[model samples]
Target chain A: MRVRLRRQATLLATVAGLLLAATPVAQAYEPVNIVHTEKVQAGPYPITVGFSTWPLRAIQSLDFTFAPDGGIEGKSGTLTMTPATRSTESRKRPLVRHPRKLEVWGLDIRALEEQGDWTFRFRLDGPEGPGEGALTLTALEPPGPPMALNWSLSTLPLIGLVAFLAIAWRRTRAEVLAG
Target chain B: MDLTAPGAHGVRAAATPRTAARGMPTAMALLAGSVLGLVGLTWDVQWHTDVGPDTFFTLPHLFIYAGSALSGLAALVAVLGATAAARAGRPLDPTVGGASVGVFGRTFTAPVGYLISGVGAAVFLLYGMWDLWWHGVYGFDAVIDSPPHIGLLLSGIVTMVGTIMVFAAAAEHRWGRVGTDVSIALTAANVTITVLGLTDVGGPVDAVHTAMAWLVVILLLTAAGFRPTRGGAVIMAGWLAVIQAVTWWFSPWAAYAYADAVGLPVRDYINGVPVMPALMPMALIAVALLIEPILKAARAHGNRWLPVAAGAVAGALVAALQGIQDSIVYTYPTPGPGTLLPTAVAGALLGALAGHLGWRFGHMLRLVNRTRPEGN
Candidate 1:
């Protein structure tokens, strides 16, 4: 009876080892994909955070996505985005969109106050468990038009002014000569 | 105070000095209004640079409106007063008679300068409406050279010129040297404002562009100098210096106080550094000094080309001096001959044009004097 119990225990141990080996492979094969992945870490439970727009720039729209190790199908929580520079205050809102094709939580931001590093903090309480994490990014200003364009636009009023002066001069000259 | 005296063309001559002195209050009101407008404009620009756009009814905007309203109202009152005098068989006061024009089946009268200034004020009011609409559609301008802003500046210039004209005519009356001095000072003030407005385009970094802008400014100043007023250059220089000093002293404090009041984060406050006043005025003053002697010589000789030559020389000096000053101030690379050549040429052309305009304005003054009624 003791020998039979030992054989059963060894068999159970072997099956457990096999399941552990396959767990990572299963995670790798999951449909969850993150583009421009800024950060991926476990916060009690696993979470992936990244910007939707690559190479963040000032005066441009910003889009961010957060996904947990488990699919977002049954997730419920809030995301807060704060500019690290404190030039503007943080914006806090709950996640509502669960795009069927993308299968990830998403948030769209229109414009940042100024160019600098900004921090994004996330909190999620879902069926898998509670999760929290933070990510930081640098916002750069986009390249402007050439110096010539700036010069042309700046000096455009001079033309109108000169024309006005010329017309006034002509009228004055005529009146004087006639008199 | 006998007001009945008919001159040529069925127009009445000016009222006696005693009667005309009553118009001094109206003149003072116009002058005060103009100063308010200038201050409001400068403050508005600074506000935009520091705090970005605020509401349409911002304090600076209200100041500007008040100025226009006051100046326009004063001008209208003067016109109405003159018309009433003329209809009642009284001679029009020279201050108002010189500016009268028949319109809308009624004879409207003010100093010619005030008449033109009032029209400019009306135009400015219309443009203000347009500017608000423009901001709504295209968003607030990141730069100052927008169409509405240009229109506003032009109207402001017209108003200022009218003020100068009114003062000039008054000086010829019993106001004497005092009126002339005030006119000269106002001319200087107007020139200073123009230079300030053009700083966006004529920044010290762009040598050629700065030269071009200064060329135009120098021409205008030269034309203003044509007035038969002594110490024209000194008045221009004094006003420019005073304005610069006041701006440098006040701008930084104002900006800081405003930021603190608004609760703007220290990191977000851009107006901590006081704006550097433009040095182009100093260069123009140098030209003005040199031209004074040339103007005297030209008048003594009755030499037609002398003023033109003087203008050209002044323009060239302004361009060259401004180029050097800009290079030093902005730490810009030395401008090549190519840039210098074009700037010099433009300056010369503008100088000649200025000379012609100056000659014409002087001639107009002479014509007015010739046509005036003989003394009682």
Candidate 2:
């Protein structure tokens, strides 16, 4: 009888263990973040872009503007942008330029939406390196939407159920004694 | 019949007070829950190839696995502690003999607590689901990202199985208790799934989190030899607070410093990926763990320093972990200003509220007796 009791206890534990061991996914479904920034002390500042998220899909928008250090001479410059997929690293996209100060408020280059080999090259026409490379652009297509699989709210009903059992069990024991 | 046996009546009567003391587990559960809330929020982790061989070998995977393991360890600790403590006091009444049988004709020899564990497992899973939705899926914009996709699936399975166990255990307890092997099997299956489901091997930091969790479990079990009730709860809470606080502070600092050293931006924004808010939750977890033990100990001992000490430990850990974790990331890409601050603030506030509410609700209620008539 003792052995049987021990076995039963073990079974109960096994079940609980299995429940916990199951893979637990997150509730949120936010997009991956991989943008970096640099503040230049001189006139133009340099900015490097980093991308993460396998199976490159698409970028909806890329917008940038110039913020002068001390004086604002209607900051105008000839700029270039290039993109290369992962596969063909050397097949670089040429620098597509705009003559005016602020070109393309929001550029959506849909052509770069191919499968393989992707990288973007940027060069702003200004003084050499230091403060001459200031640029800010928004990369679009932040993942699909946040997922709903949070544990806290999901477990509220369970809390209620546990309470019910505890109460019921306590009562049963009480009755067995009273009887 | 044995109620009249030599010394049997004395033993059975003694069981009454201890049985009454069974009420203490409920309080411990509340305390553990609060601690879970705290650590779950405050712990921070980062994955990188830049660390030294020693750190590279240890920390990362620990944080990832800590969540699932903690729940199971907590339940096991509760069971073993209660059973052993009761045994030390007086021989249990043989009247509650044989395994607790359920309505469905199931039978098991383990103490009634085994059956009660189903309730705890269900609560754990449900909490995971809510967390996934609020923080994991909907809260973050990285659903399509590589690693989170794995997180989504793993957390989902845990939640589903946990729910099933809840109902199954309830049915077992209410009807006829299932054998102990069934419970163990349930746990084994869950662990297997998590192990198999993990896509990333995880990094060094994750390993640290896992080790800490393992240590916490061992400490909890060891504490059973002491006061059982008080010791178990305190150790569990303290362990959780320490682990989470350390993790919270470690990640960003590593990221920030690495960025400065490597000459990369403090923060990085991948094209489709969203910057993560992993740190805020770490702070929250630290605060919650701090409050649980303090409140429980305070209510019991009525000592001022107990609460203060708990708070100080929790706060310091949160700050320390935050510092360690942020140093690397703060300088990497520069957190778009005010990005992580809000999460930390929100997590702290929520942790405090949860701590107070959990204590009140858990301890305030008087156990209701609703036993059915005999031979019904």
- Strongest candidate by lDDT: 1
Stretches of candidate 1 exceeding 4 Å from the true structure: A1-179, B1-9, B173-226, B265-280, B327-338, B362-376
- For residues B1-376, write the lDDT of model 1, one tens digit per residue: 1112233224544556665566666666677667677656656655655544344665567767777777787778776776676577666556542545554445443445566667667777877786686555433433445556666666666665555556555545545234434444444444443444444344223444444444344434434443454345445555555755675556555544554554432222243433334443446566667777877776666566766777677666666566666666656686776767666666676666656555555545433312432211
The global C-alpha lDDT for each of the candidates, from Candidate 1 onward, is 0.55, 0.32
Kindly list the per-residue Cα lDDT of model 2 for residues A1-179, writing each as its tens digit.
46755775687579557744552322121222434333433334343332322223333222222233432333333333333323432332222221111222112112222333333433333344423332332333333332233233333444554564455445444432222
For candidate 2, write residues B280-324 as lDDT tens digits: 323433444444565456556644344334433443344334434
| Runs with alpha carbons beyond 4 Å of true place in candidate 2 | A1-127, A130-179, B1-45, B48-237, B241-356, B360-376
- In model 1, residue pairs whose N, Cα or C atoms come closer than 3 Å (at least 3 residues apart or on different chains), thus clashing, are B3-B91, B99-B112
* Range of the 10 consecutive residues with the lowest summed lDDT in candidate 2 chain B: B367-376
Q: DockQ for all models, in order?
A: 0.03, 0.06
Candidate 1, which CAPRI tier?
A: incorrect
Cα lDDT, model 1, residue B364? 52
* Backbone clashes, each candidate: 2, 171
